[model samples]
Each structure stands twice: as C-alpha cells, then as structure tokens.
Target: MVFWLVAVGCLFVGEASSSDNKITAKSIRVVMDNNYPPYAFLDAKGNLQGILIDQWRLWEQKTGIKAAISGIDWGEA
Candidate 1:
C-alpha cells in the first residue's frame, strides 16, 4: 500500500520539463507525520522511520532524485 503511494508520488514530482522530458531539478522536500506509527514516525535516533521511509528509499534509488524527508506532528501534516 505504502509502496504504491510512494511510487505514484515519485511520478508526480514535476521537477522536470514536461515539453522536453528533461529534468529541471533533483531535490524534493517531504513532510511526514511523526505521530503516526508503522506508517510514519520518528525513530529513537530522530530519523524518519516506518513503511513510508523505506518506500522513499526505493523511490530515490530508482529515480535518482534526492528527497529531503522530514517528520512533523499530525497537526502539521
């Protein structure tokens, strides 16, 4: 489930030139809910964790795009 969502999200990053199919940028900013468990949360070391985090890793590996992932409380998400 999370894997599909992350994969779809990667397709819509829109940091590329639609007309020419050229990349315009290589970085993305993402905010995940730290309050959610197993889906999104912060680890003991203050790093993002859970299924979404792992999926993002795969997304970066396949697309060569850099994502600056961050975690915030539910209210912010």
Candidate 2:
C-alpha cells in the first residue's frame, strides 16, 4: 500500500512539471495619436514618451503583460 501511494505521487509530480512547460504568446497593442499631449505623444527624439506610456509600463510590470505603442492619426484612431 505505501509503495503504491508513492508511485501515484510520483506520477502526479511528473504530470504537473510537464504541464508547466506550455508556452503562450499574449500581448496588448495600444494605438494613440502622436499629436496629443498628456494622453499620448512623441518626444523631440521621435519616441513615444508621455504620461500614458509610464502608466502602461507600470501596469505591464505588475501584471506580467506585454504592451506596445503605435502612433496613429487622431482622425483615424
């Protein structure tokens, strides 16, 4: 009985380890106007830099989520 219990435990551990190896790609893309201020905009160097970017970076770090920013025209987006 003890040997059977040990074998079952081993099987469960093996299954758990294998299940943890699965990889999934999940991300969120954010589009905002490059001309807008505070909400979203680009800096002098032509990089997306603003309050929203800082907020999103913190959110991504805390939630383990990937994020990307793209420039869009105000009329289009």
lDDT of 2 at 42: 81
> Model 2, range 3-28, lDDT digits (tens) per residue?
99999999999999998884454678
Q: Pick by lDDT: which candidate is best?
A: 2
- Alpha carbon lDDT of each predicted model: 0.83, 0.84
Per-residue lDDT tens digits of candidate 1, residues 39-66?
8887789888899989998998988999
Off-target runs (Cα >4 Å) in candidate 1 are 1-20
Q: TM-score each candidate.
A: 0.67, 0.62
Could you tell me how far off, in angstroms, the CA of residue 39 lies in candidate 1 after the best superposition? 1.0
For model 2, the run of ten residues with the poorest summed lDDT: 20-29
Q: Give the per-residue Cα lDDT of candidate 2 at 20.
A: 83
lDDT score of residue 29 within candidate 1 = 89
